[model samples]
Target: MIPWVHIDTGTIPNGGGTLRLMRRGQEFSIQLGQNELMNSRLSGSEVALAELACGRIAARSGARVLIGGLGMGFTLRAALQTLPERALVEVAELVPSVAAWARGPLAEVFGGILDDPRVRLLQTDVAAPIGAARAVYDAILLDVDNGPDGLTHPGNDRLYDHGGLGLARRALRPGGVLAVWSAHPDAAFTRRLRDAGFTVEEVPVRANGRRGGARHRIWLAARPDGAR
Candidate 1:
């Protein structure tokens, strides 16, 4: 067995805690403290996050997407694959080092997706773009902070709260989708999505997809057409 190597470490902005990058041969992992946030070998759910959301808006001409986290570029790469040539994707990553890791230690895992013509990487909190936009995005895909129940950043809770859901609803174009990836299910959060006026679907997927791994949940919340 190849022993894991500690490649690098980065501090999360706004006192979010520290992230450690680890590798064992070709396998890579990004972790916060004892919790592993992402791994190269387990990209199935992350891929689903993009495929499921992009599938919802595939018919929209020149679709625009906002991805809340840039971990390993699984969702971005999947989104680029699923979206049309004219589509544009904006990826917001709050931690600077995560972006750097994508370019540096995890470059092979990212496969140069950062330089894609449709990709625009924003090194800031995803909330900044969500709050600034109005019916701007065709889809907003959030794989941030272990879903609504965050572990690394306390501030990430706002993205799952009532007001945060409201902002997301406003930022999305009518009929657009807000897809969120979670390590676990939150029935209350599902209720919140309904209360926020979104047509919600809770999907249970394996971390490793068909091969089977830990069960995870993805919420596909669609902003109804003509919704304010």
Candidate 2:
């Protein structure tokens, strides 16, 4: 087995803990404390989530999209491929080192994406972008933390709550979609989407693509044209 090399490191939330970026062969992973948070190899969910989020909106000639996480750049790359030439994607990633790894060690997989004119990388918490956007996006795709029950960062739990869902609803354009990727099911979180005045639909897509294997749920919520 090849040895894993440390690419870089950063702390999550005021240095609450450290996140180590490690590489083995062509794959990369983000580890928090001792657990592997996310990796590039098993990125099926990222692609599915991005596809589900973009959906028909991506077919629109000039749609604007917001992607909450940039892990592996699978979601961004998928979106870039599906969307039209004039589409725009704003990627909000909290960890700067993750971005660094994307450009450096993991460059072969994610580097070219950074140079795409359609993409804008924002090094900030996903919440900030959601809060600040004023009904400006056609779709918002979130895969920041593990799931509704956040394991890496407790702060991310709010994203699955009514408050965060409400903000997401407000940030989206009329009939715009808000797609969330989860590692597993969260019934209560689905209810929260309804409570926030979104027409919700739960879809299961494989981690590897539509071809086969264990499935994961993707919550697609849409804000009503007259909600606000």
Candidate 3:
């Protein structure tokens, strides 16, 4: 049996604890304590997060997307694959070390997507970009924390709350979609989305691509054209 080798560790932003990177041959992982945050082997839910949201906005030309996390770059890469060439992506990663990991140990997984002309990587809280936007983006996908529970960063809880949902609504164009990735489902968060004037859909997806793995959740919320 091959033992997992610890490669490195990075501190999570906002006093969110530390993430340890581990490798065992072809597989890689980022973990917080004993719990795994993300893995190179299981990217189905992350990819679904991008594919589902982008598919909703496929008709829009030059669509703009904002991804709230850079976890192993799976969501970003999946988005890049799904979106049209004219589309653009802005990835907001709160932890500086996570970005460094992406460019460093995880570079092969990221595959130079950071250098893509269509991308602008921002090392800041997701809220910074969301607050600055006003009907400017076609889609906003948040794969932060452990979803509505806010496991990594305590501050991430606000992203699923009413105020955060409100800002997301304002940031998106008419009929724009807001996608959220979670390790599990939250009924309260789903209710909050509707309260924020978004028509929500909670989807169940596999962790690994079309195969065996734990089920994850994705919330697809769309702002109607006439939504205020």
Q: Give all TM-scores, in the order shown.
A: 0.98, 0.92, 0.97
- How far in Å is the alpha carbon of 176 misplaced in model 2? 0.4
lDDT of 3 at 132: 88
Give per-residue CA lDDT, model 1, range 66-121, as digits (tens). Answer: 99999999999999999999999999999999999888888888889999999999
lDDT of 2 at 214: 59
- Strongest candidate by lDDT: 1
* Model 2 per-residue lDDT tens digits across residues 200-223: 999887776756655777889988
- Segments of candidate 2 deviating more than 4 angstroms: 210-214
Question: Relative to the unseen true structure, what is the Cα RMSD of model 2?
Answer: 1.8
lDDT of 3 by residue, 1-228 (tens): 899999998888668898899999988998888889899999999999999999999778999999998989999988988988899999999888889998898899999999988899998999899998989999999987767867778888778788989999999999999999998888989999999999999999999969869989999999999777
Which 10 consecutive residues of model 3 have the lowest summed lDDT?
144-153
State how far residue 94 of model 2 sits from its true place (Å). Answer: 0.9
